[model samples]
Target: MRKLQFPVIFALFCGMVACNGKSGNDSTPSSEENIKKEEVKIRKPVDQAGYDVLLQYIANDDTTGLWPVPDQPLPLEGAVLPYNRIVAYYGNLYSKNMGVLGEYPPDEVWRRLDKEVEAWKAADPNTPVLPAIHYIAVVAQGNAMKDGKWRFRMPAHQIDSALAIAKMRKALVFLDVQVGLSTVEEEIPQLEKYLLMPHVHLGIDPEFSMKDGTPPGKKIGTYDAKEINFCSEYLAELVRKNNLPPKILVIHRFTKGMLTNYKDIRLRPEVQIVINMDGFGRPELKYSTYERFIRPKPVQFTGFKLFYKNDVKQFPHHMLAPEELMKLRPRPVYIQYQ
Candidate 1:
């Protein structure tokens, strides 16, 4: 039951880190038709480092300053202390009109990513030190590639850039997958290389994942326990195969129908699963949603997201403090301040 002593101060830091990127596609035969059917061979997984810093922060509950270690230490003038035990420094990058991951010259993406890393390295220490969570998924619909009929397609180069940035920033990269026609299981192979990186993670959106019978964005839920398990097992096996530490699996839940088996999600002992209640527009709804779906999960970690403009309309610009959120069961190891 630790409270964020200076909730406002923590909110400022969280605000700086939450960045969400966007994705789209055009006319084609459809991904299923376009992709060649072949026996998916097990690629040799690369051995990556473990989540030492995050584990330490959670084990001891002592992240006093901003995470990712800023290049410079800014003044923490009137900041309060005795804050929450665990929280993540969410990083977002949803700029408009960007080139594709593979299509974009490596230098361009690297430069942009590097600049962000430096900014984080410099700004982090000035605030509280929370684990850094990078939002690597494309936020917009137009960003995804058109592979036949499939609208949202994740390109290979995109995943590579994400991994490179994650390694450089010493942060966790959460691949925000917008589930359209492709299922979670379908994207693993493409992401396998990045997921091999120590800093990589996954976030599934049931919001975009329409049920077999339901249309997109409908109240109908998209994935069930089976899909969730498929992801869990894949990540777990990758971690084990590469002799890497546990990896985090993030799932997005907004409405009651997004994910029906949230409470029943199988928790893998070797893997960390963060159920992030992603939505905005209303503070009451956000908090209410978190309480009902996230707070009650048996899992050890949870995530919360804050929108800059979304919260400004309803409640005070700054909503719940880090300390206040930490009080929730399992504590929030993954925090997305988007």
Candidate 2:
């Protein structure tokens, strides 16, 4: 009798190698691998009537955080839950705390993302695909340009992998870009390749923009309507030239000063912009911030975000109801759980 055992590496390799494969490969996988390999049955889609609930939440602004971990078993109560409709914003691509995407091989990030998309689709077939594009800080290292030429600092392989995943899943991708010492206009041309993709979108980090010089300790410069519109106009033209759907332009603002000229930001009819109140730390500020700044933005699609363990502690109150938030006018389209 031959007692047999499959190695962990070999098991995962098989999972990727085949469209389908039988599990249980491991003489004794390390704790990490065991966690990563934990499997859960992908549930069937929720009822059709639930679609109305999803849409209503999107219109009204109801949402809760959904955090995906590479390892660990998901709760048995893994039921399909409803969240905000508009968009999702991901964070920590460049946070020194979170390793740069460059640190991992390109395909890995997207592979994880692919698994996430599959899970969402299984739980709710109609779930609109809204993935995130992040780590613009690694691109051009805060300058938004290199040697007077617009170039992305992130490895091309990473971007390619992300794009491939988005294309395959038909998911919307936001190309997050940080304007270090430069203006938003300067970063537009460099982002064209990504913007052209149907699933691709754009995100601007105004917190990284500095006045005298580069920003400090995750804090940077601010942006105004002038810079935002310049980039929007350029993207609007590009989207029309390609006969693609309206592009989603995202701006991260925490405080009033971050967007000094928000009143002047005249969003073009052709393009759609989302103002995300992206201040880290406080949760009480989330509602008020969204009410003050984002409510006023002309763009219909607005955004909100929650940190997995971080923000949850501050706001233990739970998910915000859509009917309550939407009445403010200019409803939010996206809710992010990072």
Could you give me the TM-score of model 1 versus the true structure?
0.59
Question: Looking at model 2, which ten-residue stretch has the lowest summed lDDT?
Answer: 66-75
Candidate 2 lDDT score relative to the true structure = 0.54
The digit string of per-residue lDDT tens for model 2 on 1-338 reads 12344576677677664433234544545555555655322222334455445535444443322111112112112121233233342533434333333344446655755554454445444444455544353343533354532224556676676555446545566777765665667666876877887656778877766555643234546887788888788877875566655566778776777887665776553466667767545545667777576655433356665554455556464544334434544344554545
lDDT, candidates in the order shown: 0.52, 0.54
1-338 per-residue lDDT for model 1 (tens digits): 24656787777665444321111223333445444422132233222122334333443343433222222111111111112211333333333222223333435544644443344335333334333445446332422346421335446665555556545545456676655556676665566777787656667777666446344444434667778888888987876676565666777776666666654566654465666777775667777887677655434456677654465677455665555554444345555654
Error of 1 at 309 (Å): 1.5
lDDT at residue 255 of model 1 (Cα atoms): 60
TM-score of each: 0.59, 0.59
